[model samples]
Target: MSKLSLAELVSMVSETKSEGILRPTTSKDTGRYERTGLAEVVNMQITSGQFIGSRVPEPTYLPPHWSAHIHPEGQLYFCRQGSPRVVTEAYLYRPETLDKVTGWIKRIEKLIADQDFPVSAELELFIKLEDEDCAYYLTISAFLPSFRFRSSTCFARNCIGTMSNFFPMHGSLSRGTLDSLVCVFMHAICDQMTSRVSTFPYSKQDCEAFVSLLKNSRDHLSDGNIVCTVARLWGIICRNRYLTQYGQENSRLSRDQAVLWDPETKNRWVSTVASRISFRTSDRYLAQLDDVFVDHLVYSDQWKSMVTGCLRDWRGASHGAFLALMLHIFLLALTPCPSLAVASASLFVASLLASTLLLNRYVPLQGVTAEQAMDYLEAVQSPTFKFQFVALVFALPHTLNLWGTLVLFANCIFMLATNFGTGFAAGISTVALLAFIAFQWTTSDRFNLSLARTHDKFRAMFFRNPDASYTSEV
Candidate 1:
């Protein structure tokens, strides 16, 4: 088929309209234009020697600087201005009728022409044409862009208002379509920022690889993968913004150091990043940044497994602590103990209470998914006081569980001494001590407490400085 230009399509559409072969319809509320009789117009054009096929060429069906591709599954994806990186949502299927195709072209042209409509820096527009009678336009802005669904009928228009319903839109759109849209959005935003800024830490190849992973493996990816992907992109954007706003001299500075350099930059950066991520509170924004940086540096599966393992260990400890606390309480009620026994029981009770409270407050009791685990890990690694406090609280359940266990052991020894004789109690205590030492030696790693090795590994993972070193007493 021969390629048709935008001018030719416009001329043909206008002629058809004049001859009454196509009737234009306008919505009073949204001022959106629609037309009917596209099939008749197409037949007339072909019969009169204007075209050769049942459908016009695909090139003629799109606006200027746009091209269309059909996926293996028949979904239509539009690329803007011949750039592979700039793509619209893959929601529309291949149009069966010329009317549907031409209708899309008109809507896209009008959307781009409207100066007030928020288009991306790359001139990317997401248009969803539904049932030949309604269309929805979505554009990326500083914040979560609202979905503007305009319909020919007032009932349809009123049913889906101008509300910012992003998650709800997901229900209507397929998973693969959403994934493609997100990948395209990230690439476009990163492309725009990289072109304008000079201090991006990640190379172009890095960003491309990330987007490729999301686009290629979207079907197999879990929700955590998508979240981490977005977080990684956000980190790059934040770092670029930081370097742009506060000179590149601060590029070497860690997040803490950079924030300290200009306290005001923190607020400004938070607001800017907030707009990009659609978060409002400073705490949530900072929390998300922690997530972004951690996800940027670590593999999703590796970190997810790490956090999941830690969560499992904590749950086990919590369960053990609960059982120990109950047994200790039962023993205390049964036996008339000395002052030492009472004090030890009280200490155990207090520790267990604090641990239980923290566990219930901070940890999820149900199955901990990778996304939830990542959130916990981020809070643990966050530098902010609020997050650090919450992390400490989360750790308390495990840490205090050990303390409560020791207290319970001491109370048990006291009960043995009060009920039996000193000789019997001493023998039992000696046996218990030996068993604990043997268990530690046999099951735990011998070099687990080597701080120097730990420091070296951490530096290798996080710090790229060649001069970085760690020293410990021999």
Candidate 2:
């Protein structure tokens, strides 16, 4: 206001010009400047080189098919789309860590996209924040026209390669250590082979035995050698899976047949015939058998119980048949004038003996392993094997028991006719006939009802139709 010199006048004019110009405001001055205006000012300053060393906020990046999340403790993680449970194991704190994760995702995506056919890929990554070591696993599985292809890559601190490269650090391994490793590997293989979707039907015990034989060989071998052998076994299983898938798609085999068939297709025909004959078997027995086949490891306890119960029942029936056969033979010897009654007695006696012999020969005395049981079942159900022959052999003891009792009754009636008067014999025969008819009527009604209930249950189990009715026509 008191400027009188030329310099003072110039200073005042400069101040007025500065006051007229709009000054940029900080973010705190929201009342005067909006956020957009403030952002524009900052961008202008940065472009004009006025805001030296100032960092602009970085644009966020997220992986495709995955979502990035910040944990409560400031760790970053990524979850797969629609699958929150499937998250990255590596924690992201630095830009390098994020870059590594991104690289892995890109690599797997590229691999999946490059395949000629549809396939599945799984990736696992583990990173240590404090150490330089990292581990990653990638598994790619596909079903091809000729075979199943599976590539498992593992990168660890000590080793970097496929599953075939997994070996002890030392060239040699102790027998016990090798056995343990083999057991672990075999268990994993068995789990995959025995899974619901898997077509390989070999049991865990079978895999273990096959691997154990290789381990126990006297030839000097390294850890790598044993690992290679295990890898070969895994390849075989994959090949089998491919074959089964091909058969299911190209042939008329049922799912079970496709899964359980041998390489030559003989087992397929056998399984078909067995399925047809299975309808005639006891529903409870058939159900147990199916359960064992579905998951032998899970149903092994049930199998043991079934086998023990069947053995007990068969043994008791065999004893009864043997006694009945002896009694009938004695009766035949005692009869002087052997009529058709004697012939009936003789035939029943022969049947009883045959049933007893079959029971003794075919029935196992001790409990067998699940693998053995499955083998026995497969053998019995073979196409070359006669279903009627097995049915007759198994049913003879019980069937002959009833027939033997009737034959004895007939022999007694014939003896009465020979020794006693005709009127007395006729009266006895009439009474016996009435009793037999009543017994048969009562028992047959119950049996038919039970059979109908069993049929309904079987239908419900296999057909999944609970509302359907199964009733005898009477």
Candidate 3:
């Protein structure tokens, strides 16, 4: 097997983008590369289907609503040594998981915490994988998942120099990797997943998953979880590889990644060792994770971010208004262009009104009277920025020219109606004004308005605040 330093490898190839606490994968078809560092060793195979044995027709563990997006295929797997029954969750093998171990440990730790420990829980320790399935009757007591091992969860999320603490074997591969085959399997899942997210990466939905995962974990975005999650994600974005099936004599590409496998192939690496710990493991564990993936974990406050972003845009727009005010003042004092002066002054007044409305909507009354604060809280609790108003406000900024045109048409219509009695020009002018109004209505609604305020479609899409209850305007 060829040995190369990471520094040397980086010079040849590049990494893909990653989210928090996950390692970045490399560019696909960009030639073979292996990542090995201080104390980083894994038992993997670089063979033509020799190491990972044949397929099983049935799945070892199948949860309801399990999709390829979770565990590519469902079947039982045997480890190189003993092939002890492997029990795992699909999220543990999901491709977008920035840090697989972070999610995995979180899921397990929560399980451990809730359980009545020392009384063999129906759980499997990932550390061991014997050849025969159920040949070893191990209990929750057999697993040494104490709070002391929490540090290792932190270690798994970290990259490079920090990882040495987990393995601590700065040695040659000829003696084999530091961890067992099962450890290699888990790390392989992480490595495979990073490649998919990093290389062809796009959109907030792509990377925001890491944020949700970290938040949902037992640490619940604890300081260490956040830090390590960041490290792993950045590492993946920067295209870091793991040495899972590396240093093999043949040097072929490792087909161990679950992401690349077809359903049949994916199913073969199937066995997951689940605890018969109780009804919790057998019945509710899968449902609980399902809840997190579908609903609870996705619970976040998007309204806060949306409001803050809109405020920032408005603040910038305010500067433009200030400039317009100055221009109006200059024209009014120095220039002979009275029409332009009048128009500019009118614009300045309208801007001030708009700003005041926004300010009042956002800020509470300065006075500390009991009523004012209560009113403020009440206003906040009940959203005043209904979809139509939001649309109108956003549309209002771009409507200056349209309003100007409409005003000119109205003036013509008024003069004609007063003298000419609905003559040709007056009729045409009225039509023009109506057309402009129609245009504004359609354009604004297209961007921000939701016609059915009862359901609050737009607000639900863009104005969700987890803490605030939404009462429909309709």
Candidate 4:
């Protein structure tokens, strides 16, 4: 049986904007492409009959070699590799076809570097049979995602890299990607969906819709694009939610006039939409679920990073407030438990160090000027920053008082009263260890429960069965 080379397949995939990863199963051992470093090993995806939607379908994993690395250069792909015939939007090359691959590689390199910002490309590949033996092939098509910059410096919103560390805090918030992190996030969340709607290689209607949206004004001042931006944002949010919840993938394009405007325009539109409501009325509605909204926003990476950056300032304030209390406690213990002085001091010192480290390392609060310190606190204290604020409060009492006070209290009660110094010390140590274990168990269990519930609710809200008749609420 004759097999196609990696260069041949990639050439076909890149030019067509096909969707799917490529993989090579060679009859002979293939060596690396010396010039381009394209894997001699062929590993990619193919789009063909029945897989015609813009959203890519998850494919069979060809172990050992198949991965996203094949298409490092920007291009699209669509190929079906199971049979003798392969259809790719990319130009096909034969084994030892170096020039074609080289030409395409240079073109992709230019596109990647020429962009003022970053881009995430969507590719599709399909495989079909010309004859019963699969002697001939048919079509491969590629579609590239539209990219735009949001006014905010929100890092890696829809990128793949962000998914590992964060979850979406807002409903239907789709990020505009311009970097690797955003790509990674999309790859993990959006890219993994199974399309239930239409096939790839858009129908005339899909193409027309995309073109119409593309032609619309990019400026926020224009009202024409507002609906499209809102739809696009909702589509992104809904699409991702659908994918994560029910593993279904559908082309995000909708027949509705909305869902295709510039990203920046969309952000402005959302604020404008929210602003239509009077503050008196809006504030009342917001106040009812304000805690929920604040919790989601503050617990997100946006708030996490903000609080973490200001940890030093928080530490200084915390220490200043609690240091006197600690010193007073130490003085009081000294008279009642003279023999346990060293233990008490050790506990107090450890407590302070732990508190300082928790603030500085986790949500640091130390060393800022009074103004910056106060400003930082105010920001954290804001309703928009509620989750971090809650976390900070929960942490304070434990770090400042409980750990040290409990330890010192035990030392005084056990060692001084019973005079069973060594035995009591060992018992306290054992109990502390057990307490730590219990803390870990409870914390992990609670987090797991909360996560499970959140996922269930998110799924129920957005991803009812395709057969289930429903309409968009807003």
Candidate with the greatest TM-score versus the true structure: 2
Per-model tally of clashing residue pairs: 0, 0, 33, 67
Would you list the C-alpha lDDT of every candidate in the order shown? 0.44, 0.47, 0.34, 0.36
Worst 10 residues of 4 by lDDT: 161-170
Candidate 3 overall Cα lDDT vs. reference? 0.34
lDDT tens digits, residue span 1-474, model 2: 232332232222223222122121111121312223222334334556565534575666555665665433333456553211124535443568666655544443443344322332322222222133222333332222211123433223323222322211112334554455456557646675556433434455666677667567425444444534434454544534444454454532222332444333333454355444433233344444555444222233445665666556567666775676566567766764567445655555665576567656645623665556666666665345323345544545555555666666777777788788678889999998999787876677787898899987788787654554333312
lDDT by residue for model 4 (173-262), tens = 123321232333333333224332221222334334544543342333123133234334333433334323333343233211122232
Residue-level lDDT of model 3, residues 209-306, one tens digit each, is: 54455334434332333333433343332222232223444321432222222222132111122212121221232332222122111111222333
The candidate with the higher TM-score, 1 or 3, is: 1
Give me the runs in candidate 2 sitting further than 4 Å from their true place.
1-299, 325-334, 339-352, 362-366, 382-388, 444-474
- Off by more than 4 A, model 3: 1-144, 147-348, 356-379, 383-409, 412-424, 427-474
lDDT of 1 by residue, 281-383 (tens): 2334345334433322322333343345545655665577667657765676756554544555555555466555654643452345434554555556534
Cα lDDT of model 2 overall?
0.47
TM-score of each: 0.34, 0.35, 0.24, 0.27
Listed per candidate, the RMSD to the true structure in angstroms reads 17.0, 29.4, 26.7, 23.9
lDDT score of residue 438 within candidate 3: 82
